[model samples]
Target: MARQTSDCPFCAIAGGADAHRVWEDEQVVAFLDTRPLFPGHTLVVPREHVPTLTELPADRLGGFLAAVQRLAGAMEHGFGAAGSLVAVNNRVSQSVPHLHAHVVPRNPKDGLRGFFWPRTRYRDEEHAAETARTLRRALGGSS
Candidate 1:
């Protein structure tokens, strides 16, 4: 993200302009995604307000992904998301150049049929919990 953070929507969200905050720090913020594919959909953005992944400082990249991992895991276990897809677009689908990640929750029986990227439900709550636990430990959440 080359553009200045003030011109970015993520900056506004980071500034606490009325957002459903899930997690936040000085450099990153996580909140609910309004137009969600499933419940507990969230977006994690850098507070520095870079427009794309390439612009993020080297040290900050992992932190952002860590947030995504933690949130995705939590959604899987708590919300029974079943499955999830995390995507970061550059100029291709980068509607907001502020380097935001879309953590979309997926369900197997949701009637969402697509051969492109098939998603299956978690085997059971235990399966989901185990996955979340692993992610939490790896991503620097509450291990």
Candidate 2:
């Protein structure tokens, strides 16, 4: 098991601090990104505190990706997005020093031309929850 850090925000969320949690299992957790590229943007992370993908145990990679796959589908179907942009930053541009895969909902003309991400915000918590509910249902349950 990766050691949990005392000050990692992702760890705090994984440890049950108030977060807009979208999906979770024994090994992973998915949550809405507070500053999102799109409203339904989600972050899929391992519960263990690995700082980068290379640090993630091989056995956990499959399960982590499985969760990311489910979230990608949910982003497309639940949010009515045309597709999704799934990516992971190793150490560069990784605002949070944890292993997380970004699942951003995409549309044809959403104005996101390239990797130059211009983030947008949810209208409010209700909006965030509504998005979360949609993803949760698409994920098959709160679990």
Candidate 3:
């Protein structure tokens, strides 16, 4: 397992600090992003503190991606979104040192015009939890 750093926010969230977690398993966790591109923007990350995709152990890679895939599907079903924008930043633009895949819900001409990320915030915790609940239901359970 990769060592957790005291300063990594993602690591803290993985360790069960106050985060709007939507899904979790022995190997991974999915949570709502604080500054979301949309209502259901989520981030999937390894429970272990791996810094980049290249560093993810081969055995864990499949499971991590599976979780990401599940989140993508949930985004579509839960939000009634046309699709999702999935991405990963290895190191460059990686706000958190721990590796994470972004799953942003998308729709036709939602005003995301280009590569520029115009972030938005949830109305409140209730708003975030409602979004999480929808995603959890789409995933078949709330964990």
Candidate 4:
């Protein structure tokens, strides 16, 4: 087990100083959002105190994502959400020093907007899909 050295909420939770427990494993822990952006939104945090993905040991990354995948399936069925977004804010926008993923459930008419950007245009969906597939395969399995 690692010890906390910061006041980050994730660090506190990992250190057993908070009380919003929901999921936990050797390398990762997930808990319901206290200030949820949507219903059933949860945060999946790495147990180790690494600040970001680039700082994490390769071995720990799998456990972190495995936890997120578990929550993704459960969120869709449990909350009736159409899709889910596993978002992470790094660098300039990072609120907490510790890296965490926001597993947000998205449903049609959920009053949420798409993650698309204003300056973006869909020139080709097929190419995009193919590229995504290649990336998924490279990342282990098709996600």
Instruction: Rank candidates by TM-score, best first.
Output: 2, 3, 4, 1
Give one clash count per candidate, in the order shown.
5, 0, 0, 0
Every candidate's lDDT: 0.68, 0.90, 0.90, 0.67
- Which sections of candidate 4 miss by over 4 Å? 114-143
Query: After aligning candidate 3 to the native by TM-score, how far in Å is the CA of 139 from where it should be?
Result: 1.0
Task: Indicate which candidate wins on TM-score.
Answer: 2
Off by over 4 Å in 1: 1-4, 113-143
Ranked by lDDT, top first: 3, 2, 1, 4
TM-score, every prediction: 0.72, 0.95, 0.95, 0.74
Candidate 4 residue-wise lDDT, 23-84, digit = tens: 67778877655556664567888877888878878878888888888777766665556888
lDDT of 3 by residue, 1-143 (tens): 44678898888888889888888888998999999999999999998999999999999999999999999988888889999999999999999889999999999999897879899999988999888888888999853
Q: Any idea how many clashes model 2 has?
A: 0
Query: Tens digits of per-residue lDDT for model 2 on 1-143?
Result: 44679899998888888888999988998999999998889999899999999989899999999999999998898878899999999999999999999999999999998789898899988999898888898888953
On the 0 to 100 scale, the lDDT of residue 65 in model 3 is 96
Query: Which 10 successive residues of model 2 have the least lDDT summed?
Result: 134-143
Find the number of clashing residue pairs for candidate 1. Answer: 5
Can you write out model 1's per-residue Cα lDDT over 56-94, one digit (the tens) per residue?
889988888888877777767666678787888887856
Comparing 2 and 3 by TM-score, which wins? Answer: 2
RMSD of every candidate to native, in Å, equals 7.5, 1.4, 1.4, 12.3
Model 1: weakest 10-residue lDDT segment is: 130-139
Looking at candidate 1, what is the lDDT of residue 89? 83
